[model samples]
Target: MVLYQIYPRSFADSDGDGAGDLQGVIDRVGYLELLGVDGVWLSPIMRSPGADHGYDVSDPRDVDPLFGDVDTLRHLVEALHAARMVLIMDLVPNHTSVEHPWFDAALAAGPGSPERERYFFRDGLGEDGSQPPNNWPSVFGGPAWTRVTEPDGTPGQWYLHLFAPEQPDLDWSHPDVGDDLDETLRFWLDLGVDGFRIDVAHGLAKPDDLADLPDDVEIAQLVVDQRDARWDRPGVHDVHRRIRAVVDEYPGAATFGEVWVGPVDRFARYLRPDELHFAFHFALTGAPFEAGAVREAIDSTLEASRIAGSAPTWALSNHDVVREVTRYGNGTLGTARARAMLLVELALPGITFLYEGSELGLPSDYSIPHDRLTDPTWERSGHAEMGRDHCRVPIPWEGSRPPYGFSTSDHTWLPMPASWGCLTVEAQIEDPESTLSLYRAAIETRRAWPGPRSASVEWYGAPSGCLAFRRDDGVVCALNTSDRSVPLPRGEVLLSSGPLPSGPLASESPTGGVLPPDTAVWLRPH
Candidate 1:
């Protein structure tokens, strides 16, 4: 299945507030249908303090006022269903905003209170409890523990937050936390949501001891560390099993996880038959635009998922990462590589996730003013990493200038580039060779392929800096990642990301296909 992910805040805005809302998503169902996606997965829209952009949920059961009220979300769900589309909400169960009622209760009922037990509230280390319980640093670059002022108006216990201070990690060991999440899942399922995309899925179950990090260990290393990291613990699988039980009650429901654990075998555990249906294969997301590296990522990702009896989920750009077009290097070369990689990603045998604006080949805005940067990484890293705000800018939809008909007001939550006039949907819909058109053509062709659905990839011998794979259906997808043209596989051309080399050889070649540099083509063996 091809799932289109919409970062709701930057997708579109119905009201002149410069922020995307439920009405904005409702208005775009037609566009999603035109894009030919099987379903739409929305990022967090739950009530939040906006500390980690909605990841820090203040309420799991209600929609944020910034996005819309509960009624508006219901309307959006109905609209999507009416269009034969499914809606998947992002579930952030690992943490909650510091302002969340439970967290607030924990703070008020402090010092050995039961409410404090619901989270990782521990006494500080050292005499008088001044130091943190451990040396673990936050993913955003500061100390993971934050000292809280007690209700008695004195220095008090410290709380753990793996991401931001505002996003306090929940005590999954506490049964109530799991029970509450079950209710949250059923609340949305009853309201007609098809499934959920679990955020930070691997980080739910923390080490029981909460021991200090080793001297040489870094928080960043924890992401790829399969050994005794705070994430991807054995207990996390049990949590997923319980969530899967709730999802199983609703027939046809799905669960996708955002798991970044490494050593493919360990990462695959999240997708065991009783856990998540699939987890995002982020290896490809970080892979540079090189054939060998991408092929290796695809192979390892598929193999691991296969062992776990789960489908692999492929994605390129997302709200957290720099946009693919810009990531490939940035200008003509970047756009071309992005287009080529999209074909490779789609042709792979698995569920694919298309980030919003990827079809338009949007570029991240590196020029976002320093003051406007909201990602905690910027401040946590002491202004070293600009963070992901650049990719979160509102997309251009129509018209000639900034906002480009995306919102009533010229202002947007994140500024759009003036040069985006040419990439608007209105302009690209008519241009057959535009990135949007290529996406439409590829999706239509892929949907029509009379192939057996398989989660396995069959690699074909190919030239250096090139990759060719035969899908289970005998459709050969080839990509040339080099700076020169490459021979096309002997097959009938189905769709090409770009034009083939122009010559008699191109004509005499199988189905007149000769892959140009940084181009990909889907072929049907004749």
Candidate 2:
């Protein structure tokens, strides 16, 4: 099934609040239905302080006012189902906002309090009240722990925060934590959501005995201390199995996990019959955009999925990474190269995540002024390269409107790129040669050419240059990786990034024609 990812704040603003909301998303369900995708994966919309956008959730069951109320969210879900599309909510279980009731209560309870036990609170006293429990850095930057005063008017112990200081890591070791999570899942499942996209699913558990980083590993120490406590611990399987049981109670519901590390084989662990149904395989998204690298990633993912007895999910871009167009689309390579990458992703086995604006071939806007930056990574890392705000700019819907239909007012949470006026939905929808039109055709072709889910891929040329691959459907995908094209063998061209050649060829000489760079073609035996 085809999947679309919607970064809520940047999608569409129906109320024109300058920030996208649930109602705005509901208004666009028709657009998604028309695009022919089976489902949409929404980024987190739960109650949060917006510290890390919506990932740092304070309340799991309630909708944030910034997005909308619970009623608005429920209505959006209903609208999605009515349009014959599934809705998947982002589930951030690894951590919670420090403002969350649970965390606040834990902090107030102080040391020796049962509520504090629910979190990772280490007593700072050494043999004579002199040292910390362990040295660990936060994922954002600096020390993972922060001191606070307890309600008892005493110097409180420090608490662990893997991400931002405001986002306290949850104590999965506590049984009550699982119960709370299950209740939250049941709350959403009862609302008829198709499934959940679990965030940092591999990082649900940590070693019970918190350990310091090895003294010899400088990088590991600089970053967060390698904590075996959280992430891929054997105990996490229990939590997944339990969640799976809850999901099974509601047939047709599914679970996808965000697993960041481990081999493909290890990734499959999350997809155990009793756990998640699929986990995102990000190997290709990070690999160099070359045919050989692409082939190896695809083949390895397939093999790993096969061994795990589960299917894999592929994603090229998301809220966290740079836009695929800018990442892989060298402006000089022309549209052909862009289309070739699309073909490879579409033709590969398993579910494909189409990030919002990806269909319109939107490029990342890196012109954010220093003063307007919103991403915490930029401030915390003191490095502009670490932030992802460029890729998270508002989508361009209106051709001439300032902010490109994202906002009518002078200000928006993030400014729409200046190029959005030229690269917008309205302009592209009317042009037959537009990227949006090509994407539509590609989606339709993929659905029409249903083949074995376990199809094997065979690479046929140099990794960086022109390449060919045979799909299970018997169609050969020939792609010219360079700006110039090499001659094609005998075949009828089914589709091409550019116009079709003049003559029907039996066996043409190896004529080096101009490919306009980065173009792709689908061919079938004449």
Candidate 3:
């Protein structure tokens, strides 16, 4: 499926409240249809206190006023359905906002109560319960355990928060936890949500002992290393199987996990037939701009999905990482490379998730002043990490100045770059040479290509610093990573990420086309 990810607060604002609501998405359904996406994968929109930008859900069954009411969400589903598209809700089963009623009751119920049992509450490790229970650090950069003061005003048990202090990790081992999440799944499924994207799917289950991690583990390794104490435990697969059982109850409804595991076999475990329909394997997301890195990422991801007997997922950038345009080097050069990568990503088999503003080639606004930063990581990390706010800036949809039609308000939730006028969607819509146009053309072409019966890709021999792969259907994708031009494979050019070279496409060579440095092309065998 060609799914588009919309970060609600930053997409578009209909009430002029400086935050995007469900109505904004409804109004933009036409745009999504034109872009050829099969569906939308909306980020968290449930009841929240705005911590972690809705990831800290206070109520999983209701809509947040910050976005809209239940009726608004229903209308959004209707709109997308009318356009022959579906809605995949983001579900956070790992933790809950400290403001949640369960958490409040857990705090007031004191130690050993059933309420406290729903979360990871334990006595401190030191004399008089003075120190934290364990050394596991929060993903945001501090000790994971937070000691709570009892009603009598003495420091009592410590609760674990793998993320921020305001997000308490739920005890998946608790029976009530599974029952509540099952109810949540049904609640949205009944409301017309087609599927779910489980947030932190690898993090829901943990070791029973609550063991201490080694000193060398860093927060970044949480997504990379399967050995990290806080992630990828064997228990998580059982959790997925439980969720899959519920999703299977409703025909046509599917679920995918945000699993951060390693190697093909290890990653494939989460996608066993009894578990998730698919698990987002992030090999491609972390790849660099070079051809070799990109090839390895794709090969590994394909192998993993093949082992799982499921479809693969391709994503270049997402809410948490620096935008691809900026990662490839930020400028005219960066934009060119980003375009090349997108073409390469799109030409591959399987589902593709296009992040918001990617078609307009919006680079992450690293210039967002430190004072305006709002991601919890900024404070939790003691300002050492700037966090993801730079990538979460409001979309520049139209107009030439600030806000760029994202909101009518003078100030948005995050500061948008004034220099983005030229990158606005309105500026790129009709310009055939613009990045938006390239996306439209590419998506349309990809949808039309009748891929091979077997989805596997066959690698074509290519020169140094270049890579070429052919599908069994005779469609070939070539990318040039060297500083010089290279001959394209023997095929008719279907689409290219950039302008082709002048002078007969270097006809003197056996091949019929010249691929410029940092460019990619899709072709049908001649």
Candidate 4:
């Protein structure tokens, strides 16, 4: 399935609120259908305080007003289903907003109260309880433990927040936590959501001891090491098993996880038939435009999925990472490379995810000013890391100006780059050589490709700095990753990521038609 990820805030605004809403998504179902996506995987739109975006869920069962109300969500689900597309909601089960009612009760209740027990509430270490219980740090930086005041106004116990302070991690060990999430799953399932993309899926369980991190451990801003006490604990599988049972009640429903485990074997565990349908295989997301790295990522991901007897996922860009257009080289070269990779990714055997704006070949706006940054990582890293705001900028839909038809208001939640005028959907659709046109043609060609449905890839021997693979259906996909052009494989050209070299393509010759660098092509074997 081609899964299109819609980061709501930057997608399309319907009410002139500078934020994309459920109605906005409903209005764009036609656009998605035209893009050839079979389903839409929406980022979190649940009730939140906007701290850490929607990841800090205050109410799992209700839609956030920023997006729309419950009725609007129902309409959206129906609209997508009517269009023969599936809607996969983002589920944030690892934590809740500090403003949530349960958290409020947890604060009001004494240290040993059941409400307090629902979370990881612990008395501080050292005399007068002035120190954190452990040395683990938050994913967003700083200490993960936040000390709260008691009813009498004195210093009280500390709570664990794996991310921002506004997001307090839930104690999954508590049976009530599992029941609460189960109820949340059923609530949305009843509303017609086809599935869920579980947020922070590897972070549900914590080490039982809550021990201090090893002193030698390396810490990257907003990245938790897989071996860290706060992530990928063995007990997390129990939570997945329970969720799978709930999802099984509704046949045809699936669940994908946001797991970042290190080893492919461990990553595959999350996709075990009973755990999750699949997890985002980000191995290829930020890879440079090189053949070896790309090949390793593909082979590793396929091997893992093969071991699990499940289909893998491939995506080059997403909301949380730098856009591929910016990462590959960040200009004309970057755009070309990104388009080439799209052909390679889509031709692979598995579910493929396309981040919003990717089809338009949008680049991240690295110039977004400091004061305008909203991602917690910006502040948590002491300005050393600029965060993902650049990648989350509002997309250009039409026109040649700032708002660019994304919203009625001149201002948006995140500023739109003026340079995107030429990349607007209206602009690209009119140009046959535009990125949008290329994507449309590629997806259309993919839909019509007569190929055996096999989850395997056969590598073809090729010159250095180039890679070739043949599918079971006799379709050969070739990618030239070098700076110079190379000979094309023997086959009938189905689609080319970019324009072919001048002259006609010759069949049955290893040194046939030239394949330009940063170009990919699909050919039916002669």
**Considering every candidate listed, which one attains the maximal lDDT?**
3
Candidates in descending lDDT order: 3, 1, 4, 2
Q: Which pairs clash in model 3?
A: none
Query: Compared with the true structure, what per-residue lDDT tens digits does model 1 show for residues 117-235?
Result: 88999999889999999888898988999999999899999999999999999999998998999999999999999999999998898898888767766577237455545777889
The residue-by-residue lDDT of candidate 2 on 1-526, one tens digit each, is: 8899999998988776788888888887887877789889999999999999998999999999988898998898889888888999999988899889988888777788888877788766575433556766665666667776778787668777767778878888788888998899999999888899998888777677777755553322111323334356787788789889888988899999887754666677777788888888787777666666666777777876887788667877889887777787545342445556777777776788899988887887458887777887777676634478888888888757667877665577887766567678888887888888887877887888766546466666533566677776677776666544456644666666665453333134232233334667776656
Runs in model 4 with CA error above 4 Å?
220-226, 503-511
The weakest ten consecutive residues by lDDT in model 3 span 218-227
Note the residue pairs that clash in candidate 1: none
Give residue 47's lDDT in candidate 1 (0 to 100). Answer: 92
Estimate the lDDT of model 3. 0.89
CA lDDT, candidate 3, residue 413 = 91
Query: Model 4, 69-93: lDDT tens per residue?
Result: 9999899889888989999999998
lDDT of 2 at 186: 91
What is candidate 3's lDDT per residue for 1-526, written digit by digit as tens?
Answer: 7899999999999999999989999999999998899999999999999889999999999999999999999999999999999999999999999999999999999999999989999999767888898888898988899999997798899999999999999999999999999999999999999999999988888898998877777666345565577888888888998999999999999887887776788889888999998878888888888889989998999899888888888899889889999999898888999999988888888889999989999998457788999999999989998999988888998999989999999889999887999999899999999999999999999888876565478887888889999877778899998898876667788999998874455775456568899899998876
TM-score of each: 0.97, 0.92, 0.98, 0.97
- Residue 361, candidate 4: Cα error in Å is 0.4
lDDT per model, in order?
0.88, 0.76, 0.89, 0.87
Higher-TM-score candidate of 1 and 4: 1
Deviation in angstroms for 389 in model 1?
0.5
**Quality of model 1 by C-alpha lDDT:** 0.88
Give per-model CA RMSD: 1.4, 3.1, 1.3, 1.8
